[model samples]
Target: MEDLNEVYLSPLPDSPYVKPFRFNYTQNGKKKTWDLLEIHDSVAIIVFNITRRVMIFVKQFRPAVYYNCISRQDRESNNIDTKKYPASLGVSLEVCAGIIDKNMPVEQIAKEEVLEECGYDVKVTDLQKVLAYRSGVGVEGAVQYMFYCEVTDDMKTEQGGGVDDEIIEVVEKTIPEIEEMLQSQSILPSPPSMVYALMWFIHHKADKFRKTFERTCVECKVK
Candidate 1:
């Protein structure tokens, strides 16, 4: 994939959020045309609590899930209240995440986001690269790097100064709750990456999760 380099053919279209441009390129000896969308880099943190059974999630309105309602029949059968139908995509429950600002390291961004979004002061240690991918390929080209971190009880009680004007509500859920959410299709409505990250953490970090919980407890006692 790195071997293929694109050449721009025309100037990019200017937008308030991003610039979209046309490109002329060759891949595998074949000439091709492409549109390159410029976007900022971002980071996401999968923060686990001292209990190891819980994860910190944020609930917020997302424009992307506006039309994700269940059918009327399904809703009726499920006994969902029609009066409470979501006007937009209802609040999404997802891992702590934020855009990587200029001059800030990725790990720092992760730590800051956890505090801002979850009200927890997390030390960005044991950083493991979970995944990296373009978020919205069709409209935007935001590349996101995802990581995992451990959170202690003291950190949970700390007052997190979330970004001003952003309505972020922190919710902690156990592993069983996570599984229930996934099975019920009520987690975040989109961004499949979050689901994948949670699954990976549970699958690969069972032993590590236990150790992290014990260590967090010890640290809290000493502090």
Candidate 2:
């Protein structure tokens, strides 16, 4: 069980799932060209560990999110080098996520992401769709669907770090810790998708979560 020799290839040319192109459109009766990235729609899952009374997240390095966060002052002062520090550069604490490149329903894709990235084997029917929005509207118009799922320790079937080449790390935090993190000044270091999803969860799912927290289970030892 080992990884094979990696063959690096040109990003756009190597991947057929994503494409970049430009087209002209009339804006206010004036023709304008906008370059866009065409990527499949995606889904993100905000999972709650009901038994543990915590939120389940997956941490992975996202270069795009990381590079965009570097301020002009820091970039100049720190002499930032992408090649020197990549993995330590931008780690995202996000929910399980994946693009809808297959023909399956979005709910099924969300369930699969939960299993692949968070190690939670959940039913597609249990996933609650929260919202759908377009991402990167300025550069691209990829739509993303957000979902929420409540899980327990019994649902974890493996130490999920994502499949194949994906190196993912699962994380859990209690509500208090999550609240503090949300209000802190370190948001520039976190994923917006994760933040938005958490906010949505608090607004819509908090009541159910509170009940689940109070109801103790022997496995979690919440008492």
Best candidate, TM-score: 2
- List the candidates' TM-scores in order: 0.68, 0.80
lDDT of 1 by residue, 1-223 (tens): 1111121124335665566778789999999888777677898888788654578777766534532554545433434443545444455667778877668778888777887888877666756778888877775778899988777777675555367767766778776666666676545454677787778777876445444444455645741
* Error at 112, model 2, angstroms: 0.6
Tens digit per residue, CA lDDT, model 2, 110-166: 998999889999999889888899866777789999988899999999788899989
How many clashes would you count in candidate 1? Answer: 0
List the global CA lDDT of all models.
0.67, 0.78
Error of 2 at 6 (Å): 12
